[model samples]
Target: MTILTASAPRDEMSGAPDVRVVAVPAGHPYVQRVTDAAGIALLPDPPVPGAAEGVWWPPVALDPDWIRANGDRADVLHVHFGTESFAAGHLTACVEAAHAAGWVVVFTVHDLTHPQLVDQRPYAAQLDELVPCADALITLTTGAAAEVRERWGREAVVLPHPAILREGASPTVVALSEDLRVGMHLKDLRPGTDGPESARTLVAAVERLREQGRHAVAEIRMHRSVRDEIARDEVRAAVAGHPYAVLVEQGRLPDAALNAALGGLDVCVLPYRYGSHSGWLELCWDLGVPVAAPDVGHFSDQHDDASTASFHPGDVDTLTEALHALLSRHEAARPGSIARAEIIEARRAHRREQDAATATAHAALYRRLRSERAS
Candidate 1:
């Protein structure tokens, strides 16, 4: 059966039975990889005005004509995320139209930014409207699914995000030793006031690490969209007193570059003030980089494995303490070993199972929708 998948270009695919994924003009590597893996077809989606590069926005106007033209080619519609852009409108209409055309609609809720943040109220309402219309709903985390049920009074399947693991690929990059480097990843550092505060806390942690005579080099990497002077000033001020802290602004890099960057890092820190799930954290786990995250949202859900560390958000003292512990553990030859390998393998296995379940759930929804239509 053919399924139409709509989301950011990051999740697009190349070929899958009758599957066709809608992606932005310039898509993401992960999307390409998934498409290739599934052997799914790809449909190019027009860009949303003012959206950052590589970000997918559902187009505003729905060309029912275009969808109707292709409707017969697929039996199901699957969408990845929800937004307020025109692409979202078109995608929503496509789902409704697919349903009207006797096809099923499946949606995966990736972010729980809705009930937590007020600015997403309209989008949240739209999601509520869309969920009931979908034949099935999927979420990345159980906590997120619970929140969705609580808010929309609907049940959803819990499927964790897929990890970044390429089979049959030799290790092009080796892991960094404890004294080599420190790394922090930030998707965006300018949401609530907490964005800057998190950066400050990380800087403080790095400073504490330096003071302890640890020959560690801190590298803070962020996306290019966050190049505003205000955010840059905050970063500058945060690391102003620390000689070892270096801030780097980079555009999207190729997969090899990304893997290399991740490989050379001894510890990867995510200092988010609020958020339930983090794709970055998943990447860290997959790469076997020791992680230090704030224990607020989904970070609390993470297992207490030897390779991971958690701290309170916005608490410089606690974050510094955690960093110190990680460094000490690193120096004692405690971080790199079979323990880290085991954690990475377990997490990878779990993600693979989740991906398989997600694919199976979508297929099941398609069958159920077909049966309903026949009835």
Candidate 2:
């Protein structure tokens, strides 16, 4: 690889108005929301033909050779996702190349554990290579920052995630619904998931609710993918065994439709088997929808809101109980409930404050890193 022999871009500022970042996948919603007007200009990812996600995939910037060849294009290398794309040795080479090329490397520890893999060791190896070498570390929660410090011996900044749906967004985005629709979206199962198990648990919850003569339904939504064929079939079989369980789709919905599907639900279950943080939880919060997430990683620490409930991962009873509790709370505030409006508005207000803070923190860090290099 042709390494840049300079030692001083180390971050991205020389009194410039904005810091240019070569984010691994700049097109992701989280990245876009946080960096928007943050004085951080994210260089676009390399174009890919016919990409399904409407963004880049397997980000080209993660490649060691890419760093070596075009490291000067940006002031910082901020990697938020796509660590599963490289091996330990390869990731190490990329980091080393960044230093040699004078680019500051900022790694956000989005996941201490990879959600797509059953084996943790390989991902561990990759983390071992990157974490120690990162100039700055960031995670979404203090709980996760503590874990990062304990595991990688690094201090990571705790930045709350920005709002996906900004404040004052049209309330008509989600059509109103009365039924207690408990959603378990198993799209491609996310590879490492408890969604099938959650579906069974949800089915049980609905059955009990029906027995009590409640307008409740376990809504199972899924679409097949090569990585989750087994998981999809398993969920389908489970749903088939239950006459009351409803399967929403076998094909993926567009963004508007997906958001509507989630908004239409009274409760959405997060069925992660393992991992850290979640964009889905944040999205649900933005939609003013209640969520019942498994107690794994720092999900419990992400937000202090009554709308979110936590259950023991893999425990059907706990998940079911969480569903009951969340639903009870949701129903208590309905039919032009002001309490519901306050919660939604409060969340949006908090996100407004958090967004400003998040932007300022990132901008300050980038400036500091850049100054250190220039000095």
Candidate 3:
């Protein structure tokens, strides 16, 4: 059966004509939330019909031939993350195929710099291919949009990130005593994370806090993958040497476990030495977990100054100071910590409105692109 047809279904409630979008990696939470919010119906992601059986995400969805063959499946092809899994040339081919098939192409600028790469050149090349060709562009922050304009001469619609934790999904805030729990998660040890350096600095800071009679502890959590990738002995020794620090090694946490882990922390330290805006930072905000991030690529701009503690990357003293300040503020705000109910209430309204706005923007863009293609 064809994926899209002239008789494609309309919204039963609104009676508005609808279009099906093929989000590159439709399963990602960010993609799901934004598409739902935009009121956009997405084509179900499977092996693009006759494509290989096990090739779920990359190469298949990113393939130009797939875009051409499955043109009926999507009124628009919306590209976001997953470009890193393929070469820049492949991305160019996919975009070209969409245009050749007269399909609307929309791309969301999620990463200014690829998170896993030490150098920015490859991602920059990818952006060079995508930005100019996309029918519509979206990004999360005004800062990021401005960069797109300056760098690529493209204007992007700036949309706020929808709350990662769905509204009314229990309270994110947990009551805590005077003891402060600071957490640093080294997940699979991405190149962006300077784990050892950050660990050393954080441990020292936690120890100093202890000396000052503050009940502060640093919990360094690592994915099991780190054990094989890095020198396990060195990592364990770094965590063990600090009496105030404890290392926990586990495999990737499922969503529930991940939420629980983040919710349990008083402050979540984002130890990314370099990179662009982070979904982790946004998730922390949703959980009412304050984040301490290095002053890199719009991390500090993602939240209000009060919500995020920013420090210079690789500067132990700066990170130590930022953590100390955040902890002090936590104490100062005693009896006034964020409540779960408050976060839920705020998120409910924000999520509803933002989702609507996102939907409106996407619908409008799709309609315009469709109209343009017809003309």
TM-score, per-candidate, Cα-based: 0.74, 0.87, 0.87
Provide the global lDDT of candidate 3 against the true structure.
Answer: 0.75
lDDT of 2 by residue, 125-196 (tens): 988988998899888898898998898788888888788774456244443456677888877777567767
Q: lDDT of all predictions, in order shown?
A: 0.61, 0.76, 0.75
lDDT at residue 231 of model 1 (Cα atoms): 70
lDDT of 2 at 281: 88
Alpha-carbon error at 109 in model 1, in Å?
A: 0.4
Of candidate 3, the 10-residue stretch with the lowest lDDT total is 1-10
Which segments of candidate 3 are over 4 A away from where they belong? 1-17, 37-39, 48-55, 171-175, 211-213, 332-341
RMSD of each: 6.4, 5.5, 5.0
lDDT of 3 by residue, 233-318 (tens): 55677898676788999999877778778877778898787887898988777666678898888787776547689888767678
Ranking by lDDT: 2, 3, 1
Worst 10 residues of 1 by lDDT: 1-10
Sorted on TM-score, best first, the list reads 3, 2, 1
Residue 242 of model 3, lDDT score = 71
